[model samples]
Target: MCAKKMTYRDALKEAISEAMRNDSRVFLMGEDVARYGGTYAVTKGLAKEFGEDRIRDTPLSESAFTGAGIGAALGGMRPIVEIMTVNFSLLALDQIINNAATIRHMSGGQFRIPLVIRMATGSGKQLAAQHSHSLEVMYAHVPGLKVICPATVEDARGMLQAALDDPNPVIMFEHVSLYNMSDEIEDNTKVDLKSAKIRRSGEDITLITFGGSLHKTLQAAEELAAQNIDCEVLDLRSLRPLDHDAILASIRKTHRAVVIEEGWRSFGVAAEIMALVMEKAFYELDAPIARACGVEVPIPYAKHLEDASVPQVPDIVAKVQEVLNSDV
Candidate 1:
C-alpha cells in the first residue's frame, strides 16, 4: 500500500496545495490565512509559495471578506474563504444564506456559486461560547449549499479537492479538536468526498457520527465491544448530501441506531438522521433511534464545563445502550 508519514494537518495542507497548483481559478482568502498562515495554521507557507495574489489575506470583517469571496466566485474565480470559526460565520449570515446560497436557483440557473468556505468549529480548548459551535445543521439547512465535515486524515487531505471541483458552493467544517490527532495517513489514493464510510463493522448497532464527535463514537464503540455488543460506526463524511444508502444499509444490518452530534440537542443534524432513519429504515428498525448531542446551554469558559457541554464517550455509550434496549 502506498503510504506517508503525515498528520491530519499535513494531509489537509497537501490537499489545498494540490488544488491550488491544479486550478488557476482556485485561490484562498481570509483573515490571517495569507501571512499569519491561518488561525489554525493549516494554510501556512501557502502564501509564500503562491504569493499574495492567490493566497490573499483580508481584514477581520467576516461579512465583508465572505461577500468578497462570493463575488469573486460568481465572477469565475474559485475562492476558498476561511472564517476563523463558525461563531464568526454568523456575522456573514446575510452574505452566505441570502446571497451565496440562493444565487444559482434564484437566478433561474443563470448563475452558480463555485465558492468554498472553510471554517473551524466545535469546542474542546475551553475557547468558550463565542468561539465554539457545531454549525453544520445551520449550513446544511440551506437548500442551495453543500456541507462537508471530514473527520479522518485521508478526508482532511482529499475533501478540499473534491469540494473545489464541485460546481456549487460548499462549506467545510474542520473541527479544532481534530487538528493534532495523529493517525498514519495514506496520501491521496483512497479519498472520496461523495460518500460515507463504515469505520468499524458490527451487527448489534450502528453509531452514526461526524466531525469531532466521531472520535468519541469510536471510543464508545470500542467500549461496547468489550461487552460483546458489536457496534458499527458510520462516518457521515458529507453532511448536506448525506450518504443515505450507507446509512440505511448499516441500519438494515444493525436494526438499532445511535447518532452522536457535537451540536446542540435541539434541531441539530442528529435530528435530521432520526428523521431519515424513520423514513428510510422504519420497518427494519428493532428499536427507536437515539441521539447523543451537546447540551442546549452556551459553552462555558471552565475546562470541565466546556468538556461537558459537548457529547462525550460516556454519553455515546449510554445512548447506544438506550437504543439497544428500547423498542420503537
Candidate 2:
C-alpha cells in the first residue's frame, strides 16, 4: 500500500468523514464541531461536506448532548459525540456511565448503545487544570464502556471506524499533544482496536504505554538502544479489554518492564498494568516492574510545572535503566 504523510488531526478527520460517508446512521454532535470547525479544528470542513444535519452543532451542554447521543443510539442511529476535552467529559459522566454503558446489560441484551464518544485527553500544551487531563483511566474503570487511545497517526485514522462498528459504547481518547504530530500512513490502512501493538521489538526491557506517552516511550527506547539496552515499546491501543496475552508475552521476553502513563501514579493505568504483570508474569521476571507516571498534581498553566507533572522521555529512560540495574 502506498503511504502518505499526514498529521494526527487530519487522520482523525479522515476517519470520521469515511465513517459518515459509508454509514448513513452515523452522525456527529458536539460544541463547535460544525460551523465553528471544532474546538481543535479537526472538524473544519466536515460540516460543509456532510451538511449541517449530519455534522450537527450542539450547545455548551455536555450532559444534554451526551444524553441525546445515547437516546439517538437507542433509536437505531449511530451518534458520534465529541466532548471537547476530558475535563468537560465529567459533565456527561452520568449519561455515559449510567445510561450509555449500562443499557445493554440492563436491557437483557435487547438494547445496545452503539455510540462512539471522542474527546481530547492528556496534558502537554499548557492548557492548565481545566482543559488538560488524563482521565481515560476513570473511563476504563467502567465495566460496560470500552476505552481506546490512539497514539499514532494510523491508529487515529483507523480506530474510529472500529468504534462505530462496535455494538457497545466506545470512548476514543486523542492525546492533546499529538494532534499536530505527523507520520506516514498507508492509504488503505485499517487497525483493530483490540490487541496491544509492539511499536519496537527488543529483548532487554519492555516499555509499556499508550496515548500521549507512546511517543515518549519510543524515544526513550531509542536512547536505551544507544546505551546497548534493547527496549521493546508496547502500545496498549485498547485500554479496557487490555490484551493480557500481548503484555505477558512482552514481559516474558524482556524480563524487565517499565509501565508509563500520563495519569497520576496512584490508581492509574500504569498501576493497573503493573498489577497485571505481577499477577500473571511474576515468575517470568528478572527484576521488579517499575512505573513512570504523572506526578499527583493538577496540571499547571506554566510549561515547566506541567512538564514536571507528566511522564516524559527522560522519565521513561530513567525508569527503564533503573529496572535494568535492579537486582532480580
Candidate 3:
C-alpha cells in the first residue's frame, strides 16, 4: 500500500485527467479552463494532453457557459463546468437551481443531468467579498443537487470520478486556501460521493466541520489534546444528503459537540448540523451543542480583518472548550 505525495491541486488535476482519459463522454468546459489552465492552475497541462475539444474554454459569462454545460449534459455528455469562484456562481443560480437541479423531476425522470460543477470557495488570500465566499450552503439547500466539499488530498483526487458516474448533477467546492496543501494519498484510494469521515477520534468533545474549516478544526483538536482535552474531528465531506448516521454516532460517543464552518453564523451549515444533533441525538448530549462560524459581514480585503471574519484555530479551540465546560 504505497502512498503518493502531492499537493491538493495536483490531486484534483489527476482526477480530471483520469476521467477524461477513461470516458469519451466526459469533457470540461469553463472560462480559461483550457488555454489559461484554470484560475488556480489545477488544470495546468490538461489542455495539451486532452486537446481543446475535451478541455474547452468558454467566455466570461458564468450563466452562459453553465447553461451550455447543462445543455451538453442533457444531450448525454458528462460536462464538468468550472466556475471561477463561488461568488461568481450566483450568476448561474438560474441555470443551476431552475434547470440542472430540476430537470429530472420536472421531466418525470425523462432527463438526468450528469453535470459536475467545480468552484473555488472560502475567503483567503485577500480576495475581498466579491471574489471570496462560502456559498456551498446555498447549493446544498437545493433538492436535486449533490454538494460535496473534499477537505483532503485523497478526496480531492477521487471525488470527481464519483461525481461523473452519478445520474444527477454534483457541485464540488474546493476551498481557495487548500490548493497548495500537500499530503500523501493512498495509491489505491477510493472515494465515495457521500458519507462523512471522522478525521480524528476522541471521547471528549466532537469537532464537526468541512472544506477549509477542516484543517483549522483538526489543528484545534491537536492543541486541545496537549491541554488534556480530547476532541473528535468530523469532516462533513458531503454537504447535501449529510451522513446523519455518522454524525449521530460521533455525537453519541463524545456527548458534547461543536460545529464549525466558514459561512456566516445565521442559517449556515453549522446551524443545520447543530439542529440535527438536537433532533436525533438530544438525549445523548452532556451539554448544549455549540457552533463557531464566520462573522455576518462581507469578507474584508485587509489581511487581519479577513482572518478575523472567518473561524480560525483559536476560535475552534475556544468553542470546543466552551462546549466541554458546560454544566448542563
Candidate 4:
C-alpha cells in the first residue's frame, strides 16, 4: 500500500524505513547495504535518510559484523542485520546459533536480543552450492531464535514491523528469486508474525509451504482446480512456531496434504510439516501426506540442473494430484 505498484522487496524496505522513522532506536547495519544499497538494492536510499551512523555498513566479515549487530541489540538499539545470502550466513552461524540463540536462556531469561537478521535464500540465479542454500530449518531448530519466511507482498511489508516489535531475536529468510515479484496490497495490509495464512481454500487436498515454494504451491492449486481437484494452500510464514492450527484445520478439512519446500528432501522443513500433520491430524487424514522437495544434491550450476534440483510448478501439481488420487 505504500508504493504505487508494490514489490516484495519494496514492502520489506518500506517496513524497515517506517520502523526507523517511528523509533529512533531502530537502526540498520550490514555489508554494502548502506553505501551500495545492498546486493539486491533493498536499501537503495536508506543511508541518505538515516545517515551512515545509523545505517551502518560493516566489513565483509559476516561473523564479526553479525555478532556486532547482536551485541548492539543487547546494549540498546534494535538493529536489523542483513546477511547477503543464506550461504554466507554459515560464516556467522556460531554467533547466531550460539550467542544470539542462547543469550536469553543463559541469562536466566533476563536478556532479550531484539535483533532482525534478513538474508536472501534459495537458488534461482544459477549461483552454485556456495551461493545458494536454504538453512531456515537449522535456524528454526534453535530454541530461542524466531524464524520467519514472508512469501507474500503484504507479509513482506508487515512481518518486519512485527519482528522489530518482538523482544526476541528473529531471522527473516527471503528467497533471491522472489525479490522482483509484484502483488496486490490493501490498506489494511498488516499481519501477525506468529500465525500462518491460508492463501487459498479447498477441501480436496492441502498444499503446505512457505517462502519461495509457496507461490509454486499456489500455482499448482490453480492447475489442480482445473481438473476438479480443490487444493487448500497454507503459507507457514512463521517457520519456527508453525501455526499448527491453520495446517491441521486445512488437513482436517481436505483429509490430505502435500508439502512443498525448496530445500533438500532430507531433514527439510517439508519433512517436519508432514511429521506434524501425521502426528496431530492422523485421525482426520483420509490419505497419507506427501512432500514435493528439492532433489537430494548440491544445487548444480547448469540452468536445467538447477531448475531440476528445486521444486517446480509441475512437480507441485503432480504431487497434489497424486495425494488426492491416493487411497488412505
**Which residue pairs in candidate 1 have backbone atoms (N, alpha carbon, C) closer than 3 angstroms, thus clashing?**
none
Please give the range of 10 consecutive residues that has the lowest summed lDDT in model 3: 319-328
lDDT (CA) per prediction: 0.89, 0.92, 0.92, 0.88
lDDT tens digits by residue: candidate 4, 1-328: 4445689889888898999999999989889988899998899999999999988899989999989989998998899999999989999999998999999999998888999999999998999998887889989888889999998888887888889899889999998888999987865466788899889988788888999888878888898889998888889999888888988888888888888888888998888888888788789887888989989899889999999999899999887778767866
Give, for candidate 1, the lowest lDDT window spanning 10 residues. Answer: 185-194
Where model 3 places Cα greater than 4 Å from the true spot, the runs are none
Better of 2 and 4 by lDDT: 2
Ordered list by lDDT, greatest first: 3, 2, 1, 4
Regions more than 4 Å wrong, model 2: none
The TM-score of predicted model 1 comes to: 0.96
**TM-score for each of the candidates:** 0.96, 0.98, 0.98, 0.97
lDDT of 1 by residue, 1-328 (tens): 6777777777778888998898899899998988899888899999999999999889889999999999998899999999999999999999999999999998999999999999999999888889997888999999899999999887887787788888799999999988887777665655556699899999899999998988888989999999899999999998888889999999999899999998998998889999999988899999988888899999999998998888898888888877777876
lDDT tens digits, residue span 102-209, model 2 = 989998999999999999998988899999989999999999999999999999988887888898999999999899999999986778878899999999988899
Which ten residues in a row are the worst by lDDT in model 4? 184-193
**Model 3, span 203-267: residue lDDT tens:** 98889999999998999999999999988999999999899999999999989999999999999
